[model samples]
Target: MHVPDGFINAPVSAAAGLAAAGAVAVSLRGARRELDDRTAPLAGLVAAFIFAVQMLNFPVAAGTSGHLLGGALAAILVGPHTGVLCISVVLLMQGVLFADGGLTALGVNITVMGAVTVLVAYGLFRGLVKVLPRSRRSVTVASFVASLVSVPAAAAAFTAIYAIGGTTDVPLSKVLTAMVGVHVLIGIGEAVITTATVGAVIAVRPDLVYGARGLAAPLKLRVGGELVDATPAPAPVEPVAARSTKKVWITGLATALVLAGFVSFYASASPDGLEKVAADQGIDKKAEEHAAADSPLADYGVSGLTDARLSGGLAGTIGVGGTVLVGTGVFWAVRRRRAGAPAPAERETV
Candidate 1:
């Protein structure tokens, strides 16, 4: 959940800010190992896709809606470090440009929604995959369960953060129950979306999926009295991004565009779990005005756009484009850093 400004005291908020900054710094370094020439751009596309799907909030309860947190999905498709960066980039964009989250609460959003979700979901996913059958179905199942758990975990994390820094006098027990209760329902939706998306990608280009790698090795078979590898010996190394990579990338981008540009119009208009909880629990009483409240694209609508649908559509499109551009740039830089000093090191001319 995107914590608005003033929900937490300045001291706790500042502490969260420092924690988020450190986490991001570590992720940047770790992502260098995760992203390559091929996945670097894919990472950007993943961020864009997450941004798009998050716009399509689905109704969870009677008046509570939920959207893709993208942490589990991204961690499954890419790697955990990159996944954290992906959500962070989306949060940054939403905060600065769309006023969806508070600038002051950026740290809280990143810590809860980005760092905690990615770490917890990815860890569970890895553990499950190790014990489950080594098949695509297992991967999808693991993804679903990991995503399902991650939502409530995030809810608990937010509750903890609030307990430490909440501006209101509400009892922590009530807040914990309500947050986890609604979010568990939201987690179901998260599981469905994560499973379906990961299943689709695994069906097509499993190589493009970071977590699915090594899971689809050539099937071994019995020969005579012994088992043998079915595939021939490997050839010279090639770039990870092949023709199929382009196809999958393009397809994913197109799907994201369709979802954000048109499908989002039908999304539920009800408040999300966190918003509803905040209102019901009086956690939002001291919510201050967003720093970007006066921005032209505030609230996911253009300033001069007359048609609500058209304005929202344009905003979503722009958000996707912006997230993709910025995310790609960041990932590309990380990748470049990974392939450091591309040229061979020169020998000393002694």
Candidate 2:
């Protein structure tokens, strides 16, 4: 959920900002291990995809709607460290460019929606993958469960933060109950989107899916009377052309553009889980206007554009393009920092 300004007191908000900053710093280091020539660019596309899908909010309750948080989906596709960065980038873009989330509340949104969701989902996903059968379907199943749980986990995190710094006098129990209840419904939507996206990627290019890697069943051989693990044959090295990520990257970018630029028009117009809960529980009593409300792209529409569809579509496209550019640059930098050397592919060009 995108926390607006004034919902949390300055002291707590500042603390959350520090915590979020620390987390981002740690993720930048950890992402060095996760990113490389192939996956660095892919990570950017994942962030843009998350941004695009988040626009298609689906109805959760009569008046409440939900959208993809993208924590589990991104973690399953890339890695947890990179997943946090992805969501953070999306939240930042939405806040500064679209006036969707308040700039003052950026840390709160990143902590709850980026850090909490990614940690809970990725941790749970890894655990489930270990216990379940090592198969593509198992990866998808784990993704579904992990994503479903992450949404409520994030909701609880917000409730805890509000309990400490909430600006209003709403009962903690009521707020917690309402937030968790509605977010549980939202979690289902998150699960479906995560599962579908993970499954689709695993089907096409399992190698690109970080969580699906090493899922191929090990070979077995019968020695004497007992079955024994067989030594795996060396994998054949394909031509450089065969290993190129250009096709997948192009396909993913196209999909993101289509979703944000067109499909978002049909999304539900109702308020999302957090917005509904805030309005019902008086949590927005002290909410301040977004500092970027005057931006041309405020409210996901372009300034001086009369057609609702055209304005929103253009804004969405711009968001996707900007996210991809920023995300790719950030990830590529992280990749270059690995072991204080550029990735192998980069060295090839050098």
Candidate 3:
């Protein structure tokens, strides 16, 4: 959920900001280890896709709606550290350009939506993968479950944050119940999207999916009375596999454009889980105005554009474009950093 300004007080907001900063610092380093030539470029596309799908909020309960969170999907497709970075990039773009989330709540959003979800989902996905059969189906299953749990987990985290710094005087139990209940419904939507996306990727390029790598269980042959490992010949990369990567990227970008530019018009207009909880608990009574409320593209709509479609369309396009550019640049830099090249100054003037 994109927490707007005023939900939390100054001290709690500052604390969340610091926590987000720390998480990004850690993600930068961790991503250096995860991203590479093959996946680094793809990570940006993933971020863009996340940005697109997030615009398409699906109806959850009767009046509530939810959108893809992207933490589990990213971690399953890419690596956890890089997943965090991907989501962080999208959140950053959405915050500054679209004014989707509060400037002060930037840290809060990233920490809860990016860092915490990635860590928990990735851990759960890996653990399940280890126990389940080593197949693409298993990977998809694990991703689904991980995503399902991560939503409620994020809701719980927000409750904890609210308990610490909620400006309004609401009972913690009420807040927790409302947050968890609505988010649980939202979690179903998240799980479906995550599973489908991960399944599609795994089907095309299991090797490219970080979580699916090394998923083929080693074969065993019965010898005498005991089971012995059978060292099968290494499988060669197939011709379809070579083109799969490019196809997936093109398809992903195309899908992103479709969702953000057109399909987003159909998204539910009802308040999401967070907004509902805030209103019900009276936690938003003292909610402050956003610092960047006057931005040209605030609220995911252009200021001067009279037509709602045109304004939101342009903003959505800009968001997708910015997410791809910034995310790609960050991931490419992380890849370079991991490669351990020295600064140009260290090479001496030529």
TM-score of model 3 vs. true structure: 0.93
Judging by TM-score against the true structure, name the best candidate.
2
Q: Tell me, what's the RMSD of every candidate?
A: 2.5, 3.3, 3.4
Best of the two (1, 2) by lDDT? 2
lDDT of 2 by residue, 197-232 (tens): 998888888899999888888888999998999998
In order, the Cα lDDT scores of the candidates are 0.91, 0.93, 0.87
Best by lDDT: 2
| Tens-digit per-residue lDDT, 78-108, candidate 3 | 8998898899998888888776888898888
Q: Count the backbone clashes (under 3 Å) in each candidate.
A: 0, 0, 1
Give the residue spans of candidate 3 off by over 4 A: 225-227, 234-244, 341-350
TM-score of each: 0.94, 0.96, 0.93
Better of 1 and 2 by TM-score: 2
